[model samples]
Target: MPEKLLFGKYELGKLLGCGAFAKVYHAREINSGKSVAIKVINKSNICNKDGIPDKKIEREVSIMRQLQHPYIVKLHEVLATKTKIYFIMEYVKGGELFNLIANKSRFSEDLSRKCFQQLISAVNYCHLRGVYHRDLKPENILIDENGDIKVSDFGLSATTDQIQSFDGLLHTVCGTPAYVAPEILTIKGYDGAKTDIWSCGIILYIMIAGYFPFYDQNLMLMYKKIYKGEFRCPKWMSPDVKRILSRLLDVNPGTRITIDEIIRDPWFRKGLKFIKFSGEEENKDSLISNSFNAFDLISFSSGLDISGLLKSNNPMDDLERMVVEESPERLIERIEELGKKENFRLRKKKDWGIEMKVQNGKVTMRLDVYRLTEHLVIMEVQKNDGDGDLYKDVWRNKLKPIILGQQIPKIEDSDS
Candidate 1:
């Protein structure tokens, strides 16, 4: 690695990790002598050849900007050059919660409850600020040296504005498979807060069980079990904990327990003191001012057009097209299997393809499938009454996994 100073301030150190779009590095501020993790995303990777921005990156940055909580990772500053966008963020010394579970297979109930309390507190704080963390899993939850939980990764998060525009509902099906809510797999519009609660319940279960509540080698079967809410708690769990889990993992969002209810529950509240949010009036103004300052700095320094990143525009522009190596007949069969598992109504058209429609309340979506060639298939999805971009996200997060029959292709390898 190059031992050069970045932007004439941050002194680069060791490699942290690399994802499809960015590489994280352990760096230190030369002037302040403070350690921070810098996320360096390639401009070309995230933007189209014509310079159109990626909505996922834009949403992640925007949500992090507005969030200021002890449990959420802090985004200190954003800097950009012609080739890269740099995110200077807090460096949590401890690793992911997944690592902790690997070391100690399962945690005791008291310890699990403590961690769950922190997770719930952080998620509740985000919900209070109108930000919804759609993806909550062990890998995304980081631990600090102090052993406290810090929620990270907002790539799949949605803001309240986006959710409410769709009639107070979100149709985006994005999250880790084992932790995804039943509604998301069903492709039905869902309440973000309630879905997050479901994930928390799964995390709580994993903390005690060291395995997924619903697990299967066959993806379709796993989804079927999830939709049916089929998971048995270990016999050692107390009735109180099991009751709480049932409410959190409810198949119906309407009856799922809310964060407020979870906090108030006697079982969940044991050995935990809720921290009250005080002095909101001043903090709100400060948050707004800081957001503007950050935006101006990025715009002025980068000298790149960021209008698309700052605003919501055409959803069609976000559609993803993939050509997989599979026979058309086999692909169609798999798609049908997945649809049935998720409880979607399928309409097949001979010589053409298939269309699947799913509805919840006033929200509806149509997924269009077409065979471009004998070995290649194309899928396009759109919400009937809301932003089509949300549908695109759902296809990538939820449906794509089933269609690909594996983990979704990474951004770097998808095109090739």
Candidate 2:
């Protein structure tokens, strides 16, 4: 009977949408009069739902907090009461992007390319931050009142923390069937970035052609076609469109065109401005100090932010973080040097660091280098297939010292 005033701040109005575990309502912030979307997640129901991992809910909160792209639905804040968790998000006046396609059979190549540019920019931005939107479909995207694309729904997303011990592959078998990558269906470890690239390609095809490139009434048959990477672009599509589509929908993840390549494509680059958003970059100092603690931030905090309401922060569990003065290139060289001395086989990542494997060919450790500033580089080490004590001993006793410019004796199995 009464309009709900959430936390004595937001005045909740009409219901915008509903899912199995949560319902979104249109709300206005009392102070700023800003129209917002409040997603109320029923704690009791979410706890009982099957196939909905608690991890997924937690990952979405953490990932959304890190992203502030114009083309993404911004999660401004997270709050909780005893019964429900509230996600205060930017309210887009326009509805789902899917509805536009449903109404119009297809978009002109020019319009399709424009939307694809914005979409790719958002996803590419996510990839650079070690976030992979495992579930990307039209329904997950929204169009704002200004008619720009906004990527939504990071519930099934995976971050760097979700990466297996040492390998860079993600094993999660998530995503809608039609848009899912072929490698994902193989049940093998798949590169999240490549899989995302494949989804982007599919979305491009649908926008221009008005239907999925790979489609069949039988689910298994459609998947088989996807696995074989069989799809025919409409004859009306431009040659450039056909060529880029082929590359994007390529079955081999190893050969898929990267985001950078897509950005440079003759078809993709047309009229692309590389637009900057309103709040594109967060503060540099705050980013480093609270990288882990900032997720689901109470804005930005040293510890115990609201993302904690969804899940606990364990920055040291699956990952090792360190700040080094050396450049990413020099750091990789040092890692190569140590790999040689330790008799471990090292695989050089295209632009990152090395993955060190042991005698059995199992990856024991993975090191990724990030340039946070001109002089400050962040190196993250993740365990892949080693014991907890072994990982700590190797990193603390041997690797850390060597990385810090102190020469240490080669690691001995006896240390384990």
Candidate 3:
């Protein structure tokens, strides 16, 4: 009747909420005795004239699976019937931040400070792992039974790797209207992490004043005030709080205070403490045992095969202007000999590594040097970080002559 029994495990209960294209339900996992929130979407609901495709929902599921953080809402599994898709997620017992705000009218500075600290920690973890929650807001931030904030709704979340540039900026406008950053309205590329932080500032302001910072029923005037950084603190607000809010609400994404700095600020760190990074005593139930481990996790595969990331047609060829490192003259000479004899150019070199832009086109050859063991040289045809991969893919498919080789490439530049 309701298609498959929700991935053949969980049994759906009453409806929690419904939208234009989807519905959320309270469900229980038979195997683990765990309660969960199940979201179901009809494929046809998003398939009409001007709706997003079902594939985007699939992509959201893929992204959620990769994230394993305590502050983030976890996705247990994805189940699908012939015509519908279901996402099984952890159930948060507490209510929305908006409800709490409405009841309290406003939070004391001390309370807002505690909540902001927890928020910064969660957001910083996401940034380190290259995931940006583009839709951060008071409603999206849920408070658990212990009052610890849990950021939910990854439908708008995206990996930094999926984005072309950190600084090239994101122009897509998403998130709640009141909390939307100025850059979103401009349709210009903006840093995803920075944009999230801006919304956090707005949340902080609302928590203190019980009112929206920039208010207008008209979206255009609201955006104008946001772009101009036009907002004022209530008369009763302290100078220190006002000062911090000003910095956080700065329109220039680049100059905004990073999450790291926010946590270190006196206002946030004062009057609160955690035991052994195990979360506060009051929030013990909100924290998972192994939550701290994700903060410093790194994966290493010494035998990573990057040959496929390197094959391209527009290879680096010009050698005249190719600069070689003087400190590492031996390594430079070796690579120069290879580049010139092979009729290839090594441009845009850096410390801790080097990138060889092939002549005649944008195809690149790079060598990442590791000094830990024996000055190991790793070769990659495709860009391994940020926009490097996109350039690699473009060079490979859109070039005239195919570029191939195992040249060491010059390290004449710096990594920064």
Choose the strongest candidate by TM-score: 2
Q: Taking the tens digit of each residue's C-alpha lDDT, what string does model 3 give over 1-416?
A: 25435666888888877766778888888898788988888766755555445545644755666555556677766665556667778788886787789899999988888787767667776675567888888887788778888887777876654554435556667787788788878755678888889988998999999999998999888878888988988997888889889889998877887775676677776865543332323233222222223222211211121111122221222111112222233454455555566565565343433555544544565553322212223222334333455454434442212122333344466765
Can you give the TM-score per candidate against the true fold? 0.67, 0.73, 0.67
Judge candidate 1 at residue 78 and give its lDDT.
77
lDDT of 1: 0.74
| Candidate 3: C-alpha lDDT | 0.64
What ranking emerges by TM-score with the best candidate at the front? 2, 1, 3
Summarize candidate 2's per-residue lDDT along 117-219 as a digit string, tens digits. 8898788778777889988888888999877899998988987667776676899798999999999987568999999999999998998999999999999
The best candidate by lDDT is 2
- On TM-score, who's better, 2 or 3? 2
Error of 3 at 355 (Å): 12
Candidate 3 deviant stretches above 4 angstroms: 1-5, 46-55, 165-167, 272-416
Predictions in order: lDDT: 0.74, 0.78, 0.64
